[model samples]
Target: MADTLRHYGPAAVAWVLLAYRVSKGRRGAPDPARDTVWLVLLGLSLSLTLLTPAVYAFTGRVSGVPNLARLLGHGSMLVVAWSARTFLWHLNHPITEVQPRTRLHLGFLAATFAAMSVLFVLADTPVDDARFAARYAGDPWVLEYWLVYIAYLTPAFASMAVLGWAYAHMSTAPLLRVGLRLVAIGAFLAIGYNLHKALVFASERFGFSYPPAGHLLIDGVLPMLAHLLVLIGATLPAWGRLVNAPESLAWLSRYRTYQALRPLWRALYAASPHIALTPASPALVELVTVRDLNLRLYRRVIEIRDGRLALMPYLDLDTATAARARAAQAGLSGQALDAAAEAAALHAALHAKALGATAVFGPASHTPGGGDLDSDTVFLRDVARAFHRLERQSHHG
Candidate 1:
């Protein structure tokens, strides 16, 4: 009610700490870009932490929200520095998709600092004492608050749009998809708040020069809203929903990721079924070249019940025809054709092993090393379902 520590601040602080400590991820090598993101959020939280008390001192006179804004700009300087350090970290090492985007974010951060610096310079310099005292003493860098909000808005939208565009290409677990979407929703809320703040400052006419019925929304209402955001972004990980999410969702941007690897799979079978439908984004190449050329992708998914990735080799039609003709010729001379047949069978066996399949079907003359294809794609799905059934069955037993 009065915005006291026990009321909401401690919970907010705990959440901030959780995000700070836990967002390094459960069991993976550090992602510096991801690390940078956490640091910026943490730094912002610290700034808010310091600024909150300062605002409490000025409570009845100046607005807490604007104070939060000033603190955000100050805090954001740390974030911007951290973000740039992240870019250098990436450049020194390597992270594919995030590198260029981080650069773009750096540019936005630069603009934010430039704008805030200019506003401060204009308000504080001796060139204009009257305006300096009038503006800087009371609400200096008022525009800095809005500009920083706008700068953050840049990445907020970019991340959403880019992630949404890239959502389809991911190969990950299911809960992860939900986590990414949740983060995106949180991002959208953040975007809304900044945009609202920008609009609030659009005209002094709406009551900057006068007074509202009770209190201004930006000055009075939004500080708590900002606190809620920090709380949400920070606390999301502790929720059981998010704890289970990173397994799948970190890969699920708004854009799907499954498709980018499709062509590689298709090269093996030539007839790859499109089961998972999703959005498309720019093709990002894996940094290292995959050198295995003999890789055959029957392009199959395994679900649990039954899987049919049966692979077998077939001789080229011309080679088969030539071999058969030669065999016929040898047969007339009373020479055995068993050698040619044995060679073809051995070839098929090699194919089955390479595809990681246990079974092979079809005639030596027709389909070569291919196997029983239920074609309806029930194979992969059934295999997955059957495994779950067996687990249940075993557990019950």
Candidate 2:
């Protein structure tokens, strides 16, 4: 397991770094919480990477991993576990505009995770001490036995149930829905394996030993495989939408929620006629102030990161058409993309109409395929986030 995870440690590290870059650089969300997660994950990655070799050299087995390796691994696991617990707690006990019942459900998840974390620690105590065994009983003062079971098992089962319901109600994007289902199935398999292992362990303590076939489980296999599935599935939404998609699916590709709620802001303005009274025409909509947009609203914001992916808006109509040809040839071939763009133009037009404005324009109108993907300018995303805040406030207030 240690040797096998060598590449994975680096991969995990890369994921954390890449996620941070994407979040801060692309998404422009300078959240310290996100940074902390990144740093901690990175720390784990390094610790794992370094310790794998050290423990391998010291003991040939992880049963007595070196103190440095043990400390690093334990520290990493503790932080990661704590983070998971906190996340669940926050999820269950939302302090914001969350519903009471929903909050209660989240709180249950939090409590469940806390219980699991305790067991996980206790079960794992003296982990590097080969003498330490699940034998006799897990230490008393700390939660032992089934508490860990409750902690680990419940969330897995709960997630499965929740995702099952979501899959039932969800529509269209089969890949994404299927991805979610697979994830749930994977969870079920992992939990089932752990439960079986716990049973085996319990039976051993009680002197009713059965041949431990823990390896017969998907538990050991699922971590790697499930990780792969999550990688493929989670990216399905992004990859299918904007990352590398045909124009037809591109609109459906990214920030669907932002797109849906954006019109409501315009609606708010129309519903209150007095808000537009200062305008030459009460029907005219001004979606944003001039300061909100860069001086070049009509100019494309194109940038490329990591060399291959284009991440900028196209500068001109001709460039957009050219981009479509290039994109289609590169396997992004699609019906919607053939028309290339007019969606952005149409969106601007609709938003204008919604705001009772005669004209509205977006830089996307002048480009092709909603601006070339050759560069990564998340400016459009920034604008969406800006408006998303307003939309949230308007809805909540």
Candidate 3:
């Protein structure tokens, strides 16, 4: 289970995040912060992919260099760390502040990669072992190579944790804040992994034994979890913006409310065809073909109001009073009671209008109480729902 999770989990998360980022990039204007995040995900994906057992073995065999996959994988991790730091820097500073530091960051990254590569070349390990660190433990240049990698990564991970945590608290956007905090926690875990590896290397060098299981935890499990967290964190803010925009939510709400209003509107339109400004479409056709929901909803509300006014001559006070009493007996109060009574009154009025009953009206009863279009829409939605429930109960009873 540990091996499976270690090899596949981070790779899956990183690739998904990278793909998401790429898709978003096609629609958006170039943003340094977003681009840096993309690079971070890309590097993480490559590192995890290269470190997989099959890919590692294939690369080693094809390259005619034992354990060359290790160097490539480590190089990719270096890219991840560097890009993550750049991403954070871009978030915290303007382009003017970030540009000068970019050169210095790249120079350090280049130097570290060069040093690691030189050490890797000097190390005399002809055998390609997936467990390269354990196999070459305490071997002269191998120890130095591992130490160099750790030395470069330790500070990078520490800084990332610090920056991520601090910026998270400073951020106002909820998703971005949460994402930064996750990144911080991931960086902290990565630091622990690095320290554990350093200790393992030191223990092996000093003629002490460390459990083989320790390597599995530090290398596979810890890094896998850390990378997953970081990948999710880096992508979440963008994902949240794409999905949870206020306009999107409002449009969805309006669409649902429009659909819900259909039963009431259909009955009203049937009783008074002139109440409709536009001839009604079949319900399924309307659902599939309708656009400009805001305008359509506005027109529907107006039409329903006109229908109610036209039926007012048939509205009976006795029917509404009876409904109010029955609804009260059913333990409904406040807006719910009002809505139920209103629904009953409208149902009775429609029947009266259909039967050609004599006009018997004073002031219109069951006038929906709302101060604005949105409030009226909400009240009418409740009425529509209550209307359906009353119809179902009558049918079932």
- Judged by TM-score, which candidate is best? 3
Rank order (by TM-score, best first): 3, 1, 2
lDDT (10s digit) by residue, model 2, range 1-397: 6645643544464365446445644345553323333443443454444345444245524445323343344334334333322322332344353345334645654565565555554443443442222333434423244544436445634554365336524635555555456545544554555465555455655557653665443434544453344334333433454444444443343334223323432333343333332332221233232232332222222211110011122223454456557657767544344433323322333344555564323254423233443122333433334334444565698
Off by over 4 Å in 2: 6-102, 109-124, 127-146, 161-165, 211-219, 240-397
Q: Which is superior by lDDT, 1 or 3? A: 3
Specify the highest-lDDT model's number.
Answer: 3
Cα lDDT of model 3 by residue, 1-397, tens digit: 8677777777877887788777766555778987888788888899889888888899999999999999999999998888888888988899899988877878888999999999999998899888777788777787788788877788888888999999988987767777888898999999888777777767778878774665675676787778888987888887867667445645767898999988889989999999998899999987886578889999988988898898888887888889999999999998888888889988998888888888876874447657899888988998889888877786898
RMSD of 1: 17.4
Candidate 1: count the clashes: 30
Q: What's the count of clashing pairs in each model shown?
A: 30, 19, 0
Q: What order do you get sorting by lDDT, best first?
A: 3, 1, 2
Candidate 1 residue-wise lDDT, 47-112, digit = tens: 455445444335313442333334343545346343534533442355776677667766766676
Candidate 3 regions exceeding 4 Å error are 26-28, 209-215, 241-397
